[model samples]
Target: MKILIVGNGARESALGVKLQEDKRISKIFFAKGNATTDNIGQNYFESDIVSLRNLAIQENIDLTIVGPEAPLVDGIVDDFRKHDLKIFGATARCAKLEGSKAYSKKFMQTYNIKTAKAQVFEAYHDAIAYVKNHDYPLVIKASGLAGGKGVVVCEDVLEANATIHKFMIDRIYGDAGIQLVIEDFLEGYEVSIIAFSNGQKLFPCIPAKDYKKAGKGETGANTGGMGSAAPSPEWTAENQIDFEKNILEPTIFGLQEKNLNFRGFIFFGLMVTKNGCYLLEYNMRLGDPETQVLMALLENNLVDTIESCLNGDDVELKFSDKKAVCLVICSGGYPQNYETGFEIKGTDKVEHSTLLFAGASREAKRIVTSGGRVLSLVATGDSFDEARDKVYADALPIHFDYAYYRDDIGKF
Candidate 1:
């Protein structure tokens, strides 16, 4: 079977690696994939990416799997369906779950989905007025897309005012901040729950925790993801019920009831506290660093799973018993201004770890950095400590100028 992968990131690279592991998959194609993906699959729809429907038909790809939100939110799935192409992901209308935070907050409220109390603002001054009356320590978020740097945690009114200006006044994130969600801050440890849905049934993967803070001990600004570990050792049976009642069930029901043509993956960003599991946000696609660990621990046929979900059959995801850990190596000043184009070295020396490249490009014979959040290193073993040790050990040789990686991942 021939497959088409979308976007340019380690998540797509990991998907390419998993798809290749299945003997049934004959070939793989990528549309604007990263340099790392260049080594894994063939690039398709290189230039005429605007007409994806025509491109998919020209290539005759059996399965088109999207790995990013931009194309998916751009309505690639809806367009593919217009031409009878089999693709996986949410449609443009349903992608509001991730594309527009204001829409998602309203949807959550309409469906009674347990989440933080928040106020939406369209005008800059209106948001400022609300923040002035409200207390500090609130979460300020861009209503539209801002990659992953749109959300900011304000500790005082001073910081909240500054964030308001950065998003709405300065247009730091462009139209993404034109509308914003000023939410009440919920105190808890953050965790991610990823699931596969076909607009009818839901299959949950083993819970994974992603480190969003750029530094160790959860300090510093939030990056896309620093590292992640699978099976959330503390995820209990009771917790599943709480999540189902408050998040998963309501989310699926809301999708079905609202007639949102959502397929593929669903990422639930949650805050777990004594009160209950509260929904923090949602990603219509898979999580980045989390995908690395999930793919490493998966022992079943990923292609079959995708096919089954597309066909709307109740399916259970199977994973390896061993634990997996993924640590990201990024440019020095990531989630901010950072340098690129530096030739990377020592990648060949890594042993017992799977290194997925992101924000990198190939120059003649050498791999060079092209964006921040460069490469992801994944390792799996019988225990978390074993996997964490292997990740750090394998990361030693893989070096590039101004490469920054957290010293502590999975140390909690």
Candidate 2:
């Protein structure tokens, strides 16, 4: 089958690599793909949905898989469906789960999902008053997508008021900050559970723990993702089943009840504490660095699984028992101001596993940093520690002028 993967990031690179390994796949194409996919597939022109759809029609591409949320939330799948093309992603309406936080919170509340109690506000004064009256240590979140740094965990009333001002009054995240969700801070260890849903049926993948903080020991601002590891030991089989019953199932059923047919990857961000699991947020597409590690441990044919979902069949998703970890190498001063175009080197000597380029490109024969998060080094092993060590070991070989990476991942 000829498949076209969208986006130009490490997640798309990893997907391209995995799909290339499937013997059934005859051709691969990337629209606005990064330097990595250029080595594996036919690189198409830049990703304009209209041009992409035209190319798919002209090339007779059998499948189109989206890698980012922007296009999906912008109605790419709906456009594809208009042309009678088979595409993998949620429709624009279903994408509200990730596109707008206020929509998702309202959906969760209406469905009685296990999430923290919160109040949504469109005005600064109302939100600030709520924060001042409520307890300290609340979470102030932008009501729309702000990459992953929109949510601020305020430690006290002073901090909460500051965050509220920044988000609502100052408009730090632009219009995305025009509305805010002031939620009670739930103390817990976080884990991400990603599932492939076919509107009616849901297939859960292995749970992963993502390091969102830009620095080590979780002492920095959140980025898209710093690193991640699969088969989080904390989320055992029992924990998985409980989460499935309480969180995932309810979410799927709730969407259906609301007459929303959802597809693509549904990401459930959970906070696991002594009081049990609390839903934190939802992502409509695959997580970034987390996808790098999870795909490394997946043994199933991704093409077949995604096609099965498109065909309205229950996908029997399968995964390897091995543990996998990925370490992200970011540009210096990431999640803040940083320079790009610095040439990177020494990836060929890396052993043990794969290297997926995230935000990088070929400036002549040399690869240069193209975005904040540059590349992901992934490795698989029998244990999480061994996998993490192997990932870091492989990452050591790659170098750039001002590369940065966290020292600890999956330690919790």
Candidate 3:
């Protein structure tokens, strides 16, 4: 089967690698793939949804898998299906779960899903007034897509006012911050639970915990993700039962109740507290750094798993009895101002790890950093300590101008 993957990131590279495990896959095509993905499959350097649809038809692509939320939000799946092209992703309406925080919060409330109590606002004054009246450390979120940087934890009214101005007044994130959700902060460990759905049943992958902060010790602004580990130690069997009963089942039921035929990945961002697990947010596709490690632990053929879901069959996801860690190497001053085009070195020297590229591009005869989060160095072992040791050791030799990474990953 010929497959086409949309988006340019390490997640796409990891997906390409996993799909290659299925010998039935004859060829893989990537639309605007990054530097590493170019080595895995054909890179188109094109991201326009309609253009990709045309390319799929031209290539007679048997299946298309999306690796980012933007294309899904832009209705790429709808466009593909309109041309009788098979693609695995959520429809535009369903993608609203990730595209709009206000819409997602409302859906959660309407469906009786467990999440933080919050108020949505469209005006700056209303938001500021609400913040002033609320306590410190409130979570402020942009309503639309912000590439994982729109959410901020304001410690006081001063910071809250600044964030409000930046998001609503300054329009820092464009119209993505036109509206916002200010929810009461929940204290707990955050985890990602991703499930494959066929608009009916759900097949869940192993849980993962991602470090969102740009710096070590959880300080600084949130970027896409700095590092992550699979089979989160914070998750327990009891948590799984509670998650399925209250979070997973209700979510699938809600989608069906609302006539939302979502046939793709559903990422449940949860805050597991002493009380229980509370849904934080939903992502339409796989989580990044998390995907790098999850793919390493996945024992089943990725292509077959996706095909099973598309075929409306009972799908069982499998994982190895190992711990996987992913440490992202990023350009300095990331999630803000950062320079690119620096030649990266020592990638070929990495040992005992799987290198997945993101934010990198092939320049002439060399590969160079082209975005904030450059790439991920992943390793799997019998335990988190082993995985961490291997990944960190492998990351030592890789270098780029102003490259940095969080030192504490898989330590919690």
The collision pairs in model 3 are none
Candidate 3 worst ten-residue window by lDDT: 300-309
Q: Ten consecutive residues with minimal summed lDDT in candidate 2?
A: 233-242
Structure candidate 1, residue pairs in collision: none
Q: Write the per-residue lDDT of candidate 1 for residues 1-412, one digit (tens) a residue.
A: 7888887788988999888788877778777677777887786536344555666687778998888887777888888887789998988988878999999999999999999999899998888888896866899999998988899999988899999999988999999999999999998888888898876877888899899998888888988999999977667788789999989888888888998856698899988888888999988899998999999998878888888889988787789999999999999899899999999999999898988888988889999998888989999999999999999998998889999899888676
TM per model? Answer: 0.97, 0.97, 0.99
All candidates in order of lDDT, best leading: 3, 1, 2
Residue pairs in candidate 2 whose N, alpha carbon or C atoms collide under 3 angstroms? none
Which tens-of-lDDT digit does each residue in 1-412 have in candidate 2?
Answer: 8899998889999998888789878889988777788888977866888999998999899999898888888899999999999888988998888989999999999888899999899977887778777886789899887888899999888898888888877788888899888899898789998889887878888889888998788887989899888887788666777787779888878988887786688889999977788899988888887788788878878877887887778977778998888888999999988999989988898897688887898777888889999988888888888888888778778899899999897565
lDDT of 3 by residue, 339-394 (tens): 99999999989978999999999988899999999999889999999999998998
Q: How much does each candidate deviate from the true structure in C-alpha RMSD?
A: 1.3, 1.3, 0.9
Total clashing pairs in model 2: 0
